[model samples]
Target: MTFEAELRKGNFQVAECTNCKKTVWPPSDFCNQCFKEIHWRKCANEGKIIEFSKQNNYYFCLVEFENTIKVIGKISSGIPNKDQHVRIKRCGMTDDNYFFEFSLI
Candidate 1:
């Protein structure tokens, strides 16, 4: 299965560069830094919202995880503040489509 499938199944994971020892976000086939092979690994769900914006009733956030990986997740049903520490409330397929949602903590 693809990374999106795994993550949608509530599997918190990311790619790590074996050579550089750096974590990669938006999982790729090769390392962004060294152009080497990358492997999947588990990642902490905790992150800080560095920036955010609301559109169409959803707060979109640029969450920085482990200070290296930044991902966009939607926040629903709560007032989310900037720089707020958040966690993955849950991940799954919405209407059989991949979806990500977070909860402010």
Candidate 2:
């Protein structure tokens, strides 16, 4: 399934190439390594905040997971700092697209 579909189901996934065994984040239709068809795989849902910024009402964070999966999400509860560990609280899609919101650990 697509990333949006995974988020809609309250789960997270990444694309992996069956041929090359390469993992792809930000889910893509094809693999970059071997140009093979990609399949979605469940993610660990654990990451560390690489960078973050506070906006008007939200804290936007760039969370880096294992295998170099970097997802940009908003902090669910409160502010988070760089290198802070976080976990997925919930994920959903708005009218626009799938959004990942996390909580600091």
Best candidate per TM-score, number? 2
Candidate 1, position 94, lDDT = 65
User: Can you list the residue pairs that collide in candidate 1?
Assistant: none
Model 2 deviation from the true structure expressed as Cα RMSD, one decimal place:
1.6
The local lDDT score (0 to 100) that residue 105 gets in candidate 1 is 89
Q: Give per-model TM-scores.
A: 0.79, 0.87
Cα RMSDs, all models? 2.4, 1.6
Compared with the true structure, what per-residue lDDT tens digits does model 1 show for residues 75-100? 85687888899898776666766566
Cα shift from native, residue 104, model 2 (Å): 0.7
List runs of model 1 lying over 4 Å from the truth: 93-98
* lDDT: worst 10-residue window of model 2: 1-10
- Candidate 2: lDDT of 20? 91
- Model 1 — which ten-residue stretch has the worst lDDT? 91-100
List model 2 lDDT by residue over 10-105, tens digit each: 888888899998887658889987899988888888899999998988899989888489888899887798899999888778775777889999
